[model samples]
Structure formats: structure tokens, C-alpha cells
Target: MFFDLALVFLCIAAVSQFLYFLLITSNHKDFVKRYNRDFKEFRPKVLLTVPCKGLDMGFFRNILSLMRLDYENYNIHFVVESESDPAYESLQRIIDRCRDDMPAGFAKVLVAGISKGYSQKNHNLLHSLRFAPHDTEIYAFADSDTRVSRLWLAHLMYPLRNSKYGVSTGYRYFIPARRRFSNLALSSMNAAAAQIMGKSKYTTQVWGGSMAIRKELFEQLNVANLWQKSISDDLTLSAAVRNAGYKIRLMPRCFTVTFEDMSWGQLFEFGRRQMLITRVAYLRMWLWGLFCLLNHFLGVWILPVAAAVRFAMGENDAKLFAAAAVIHWASLIYRTYMRRRTFEFVLGPYGGYVRQLSMWEFLLNPLWLALMLALILISSFGRTICWRGVRYRLNGAFDIERLNR
Candidate 1:
């Protein structure tokens, strides 16, 4: 009887996951088709904002890649909080190189004073906005750690050319620097995130790492109004744009590359920070968090039990397990195909599998839940976060209170 119940749960879980996979596949195809059609003749004045803190890691390489984009009539803005930031020197080097190779307008570094914002990224961006060309029609915000394809800006801006579309966000894939467990975890999380966003109706929110918007709409939408008490500027801005009766498009053809050499501790902290912000800013998203919990439980624990039960019940356990495994594997195979095609799957063999498995592990582990809860507590009650090397307190309205120490 116990085995039968387990089997029932497993079957349900497998079927649900299979349906989820199908949804994502369909959405991905639709997104691609729409994106290709839209980019045919779309061109707009673009300002690419790269918010930087330090020149740690491959910051220069990422910046240089952006400078080399094949788009026309666009300027890259490197927003640094302080003139003495280590990354400022690297930005200067990239600017000089770009000026030497290209013309004077290819890239520019804007040193700005940090403003009051819970997010340092937002603070830097707000400062950069002052220097943004008034004639610029599109705003593309790219993180300093991210690298983009030559066509990234073209693809992202193409959708916004339509009057109905207010914002367009591209996909992100992790470029694993090493074959460490932490890298595997980050990669897996990124894949699952793509799957989730791809399948969901709220594709409005762009990944903070890479997003673009209509400058006129962004100014009219008044994102800073929503930024108040919103820990995540991306989500808040996306939500505001959508609420303003404008469409937000997600272009699957364009993707940004993120470094995947983050330590396990860093990954956990990042995830916790994200969850805390999402929970506070988007209550609806928090409501859907339960589905994630169930999905993880089914993937790791329920499916295995169902296979055992079917075998005990004289059912074709091999066929059942094979079918379920095929469904799960299909999703992985598609992602692996994308990774390979994009050359984003640089990690060694089993990189894709390890990435998928880690998500299951995170879901099944009670420890992760406990840690998340603890972080939520801290994010809610605690005043400050130690970011990079600076500590800033969370003010009443998503503004950061700089600490002396």
C-alpha cells in the first residue's frame, strides 16, 4: 500500500515536470521566432550602462567584449561609484583601446557619486543617467561581470522598437571558469531560472545581469517610484513597466555570459539575497515559491520512490522509469544543446548533468530551506549588508545608508 502511494506521487510528479518542460520548450521557440522577425530592420540610439565597483576577475575582458559589439549608433557607459575604484583604471584602459581602434564615441567612462539606494547598482545607474545623452532612445543595462555577443544589443533593442513593448530582457548563461562544485551549482541554478522564466507569464522581469528598455518609457514610467522599498531594481522596474500597460518581451535568441567561478558560499548568499528581495517586492512571486518546493521534492525524492513502488507492484518499472527519465533528460539535452551551440557550456563533461542534479539536491535538502529562512529573517530585520567590501544599511525606502565603518 505504501509503495502504491509512492508510485502515485512519483507518476504525478513526473507528469507535472514533463508538462513544465514542454511549456518551456514552446515558449522558447515562440520567443526566438518573435525576436528574429523583430530584428529585421530595428535600430535605435542605445546607451549601454555597465555599473562597476572593482576590476576583480575578468572585468576588463567583459568590458572589451561590450566595446566590440557590432551595433551602430550606440555608446557604452561605464558607471563607477568613485574615481579611485580599482575598476576605473581598467575602464580607462578599455576606453583608450576603443578610442585607438574605433572613433571617439564608442565608449565613455562616467565617474559619479553614489546616490541613496538599497542597490549599489541602482545608485550607480542613477548617477550615470545624468550623463546619458538626452537623444538616446534606448537604455541597455549590463552588469560589469557579464559579456555579450556582438548581436546582443541588436536583439534586445529590436523588440522595444514596437510601440507596445516597453522593456526587453535577454537570457543569461554562466561561463564556468573551473570545474568546481560551486561552478556546477551556479550553472544549474541558471538553467532552472531560465526554465522558470521561460515557462512563466511573468517574463516581464529581465535578468538583472542583462536588460534593455525604452528610455522615454523608462523616464515616463518613473521606475524610481517603484524602486522605493524594492530591493530588486530589475523586478520593480519590470513590474512597473508592465503595470503601465506596456508589454515586456523576452528575447531568447540573445543571451549574456556570466562568470561561474563564484564560490559555493557566494552562490548561497546571492540566492538568499535574491529570494529576500523577491519575497519583499513581489508578493505574488513568493506565493509561487511553494510550487518550486514541490517540484524539487518530486524530482529528488518522489520520483525514485515511485519507481520502486511500480517494480514491487508487478508494473513495468523499466518502462515507467525510462519514460520519466527520458522526459527529464530531454530538458537537459535541450539545454546542453544550447550551451554547446552558444559555446557557453565550457565546463568539462557532466557539467550539464551536474548542474541539473544540484538543483534537485538544493530542493531536497532541508538545510537549504533552513538557511533561506535564516537569510530572510536577516534581510527583513537586519539593517545592513556587507557588499563587496562596504557595509550599507537598508533605509526605509530602498535607499542605502552608508556606514562609516
Candidate 2:
């Protein structure tokens, strides 16, 4: 009886994974169709905001790449919290070296005063918004650690030409750090998550690292009020745009690179924080989060155990486990084929490790999930999270405390 139940559960899990795979493929095709549409002739002035807190591994290369954008009319605004920040020094060095080489009106840096918000990035952005060119029609926000392709600005701006789209968010590709086990785990997890989320119709949250929107729409949305209490401003902004009857399109043709080399502890903390915010921002999609936990565990650990159990039971039933293994390999191959040469090389091998590591991580997942839920509950009870050397509290309505930080 127990064996029968296990078989049933295995079949259900396999079917759910298959369904998720179909959803992603369909969404990718839909995105491709929209991307092929012709862009309008309007060339709006752009303000690219880079909110810098500290130095990151690819900071210089990322900043330099932005200055080299293919767009004809755009300005890069580097925002820092204080003049004493080490990032300020790095920005100054890059400006001194690259400003002369960039296109006209393409480079500028500003020091911003702290504002009342749980998000330091948003606080820095609000101050820099004051310096935004009055004629600017598009506002682009990216993290300090993100690297962009040459055509990034062109693709980001293309969606804004349509009046229906209030904001456009792009995808993120991970740059693996050496051959470390934790790095591999982090990279593969991100890639798989992106594949699943990018392919969903109801998934509207924008990645904070690479997002673009119209300046007018942003003003209309009253972004300050919209994201005042939000820890994850990107998701909040996307939700706000959708609620305001404006479309938030996820473009397929463009993507940005985020440099993340998190230690095991840091990765856990970051993932926990993300899970907490996701619960609030995408309540409906929270089930998908649970699905992710289950999928990763089953694909990596549970299947192997089930297969072993079947093997001990009888050789004839071993086919059941073999079939499941084939499905797992096929899915990984498909993902590799789809991702192409981008990060698949790393993910292909790393995915195997993810499966092995899950045996251990799965044991702690229940506790971790409980902890994340508790954090969310506590956060809802009060609004504040200490982040990046600052403390911010939120009001009952999720608005930021107006007091100066």
C-alpha cells in the first residue's frame, strides 16, 4: 500500500513538472512575438539610474558597459548615498577614465541624501530623480552590480514607445564565480527559477536590477508613495503599474547580468528575504514558490531515493524509476538547449550538484519555510527591515516614514 502511494505521488510530481515546462515554453513564444513588433520613431530622452551602495565584483566593467550603450540620446546617472562611500571613489575613477570616450550627455554622477524608506536603492533613487533631465521621457533603473549588453538600452526603450506599456522588465543571467560548490548551487537555482517565472502569464514582478519605465507614468504612479513601505521595490512597482491599468511587459530579446557571489549563509539570508517579499507582493503566485521547493527536492533527491526503493522491491518495477530518471535528464537537456551558450555550460554540471545537495538542504527546507513565514508575519505586523547599513520602518498602509534618515 505504501509503495502504491509513493508511485502515485511520483506520477503527480512528474505531471506538475511537465505542466510547468509547457507554461514556460508558451510564455517564451508569446514574448518573442511582441519583441518582433516594429518600434516607433520617437527617441525619448533617457535617465539611467544606478544606485550604488558598496563595491561589487564587476562594478567597473558593468558601469563602463552602460556608458557604451547603443542609444543615441541617454544619460547615465550614478547615485551614491555619501561622498565618503567607496563606491563614490570607484565611480569617480571610472568617470575620469571613461567620460571623455562616451557619447555626448551620456555620463553624470550625483550624491543623494538618505530618504525614509526600507529600500536604500529607492532612497538613493528619489534623491537622484531631482537631477533627472527635465526633458527625460524614460527612467531606467539598474543595480550597481549589473552588466548590460550594448543593445540593452535600445531593447529596454523599444517597449516604452507603446503607450500601453507603463514599465518593461528584462531577464537576468548569472555569472558563476569560479568552480565553487555554493556558487554552482546559487547560479543553477537562479537560472531554473528564471526559466519558470519568465514563462508564466500571471508573473508580473520586475527584477530590480534591470527595469525601465516612462518618467511620466512613474510620476503619475506616484512611485514614492507606491513603494514607500516595500522592501522589494521592483515587484511593488510592477504591481502598482498593473493595478493602475497599465501593462508591465517582460521583454525576451534583452537581458542583464547580475554579479552574485554569495556565501552559503548570505545566500540563505537573501533567499529568505526574497521569499518573504514574494509572499506579500505576489500572493497569488506564492503557491508557485511552494511548487519550486517541491520540484527542486523531488528532481534532485526524492526521485533517486524512490528509484532505489523500487530497485530493492523488484527488478521489473525498476523501469518505473528508470523512466523517472529519463524524464529528469530530458528536462535538463531541454533547459540546456534553450539556454544555449549563455550560462547553460555552468548550469548543466551545476544542476547535478543541486540535486545531490538537495538531500541535505531538503531536510532544512521545512524549518526554513517556517522561518520565512514567520518573518513575513512579523513584517506585516510592523513594517521595517534593516538593510545595507540603515534602518527603516513602515506605516500600517505600507507607506514610508517621512522622517529624514
For each candidate in turn, the TM-score is: 0.78, 0.78
Candidate 1, residues 211-276, lDDT tens digits: the string is: 888887888988755554445678788678778888777776566666657887787666666665
Residue-wise C-alpha lDDT for candidate 2, range 1-405, written one tens digit per residue? 796777757756864675577557555645555564434465679888889988888888888888887777888889988888889988988988987778637676788766654566776777777888788888888877777766677777877888998888776766655555555555555655565544454655688777888988898989976665665678788778888988876665456666667786666555555655566556656566665555645654566677788788785666676677667656655554454432332233334444443443334433443444443344334344455666544443354444335
Backbone clashes in each candidate structure, one number apiece?
A: 2, 0
Give the whole-model CA lDDT for all candidates, comma-separated. Answer: 0.64, 0.66
Candidate 2: lDDT of 36?
Answer: 45
Q: Least lDDT summed over 10 consecutive residues: which range in candidate 1?
A: 341-350
Model 2 residue runs over 4 Å out of place are: 1-10, 26-42, 104-106, 197-199, 307-325, 341-386, 391-405
lDDT against true structure, model 2? 0.66
On lDDT, the leading prediction is 2
For residue 34, give model 2's deviation from the true position in Å. 8.4
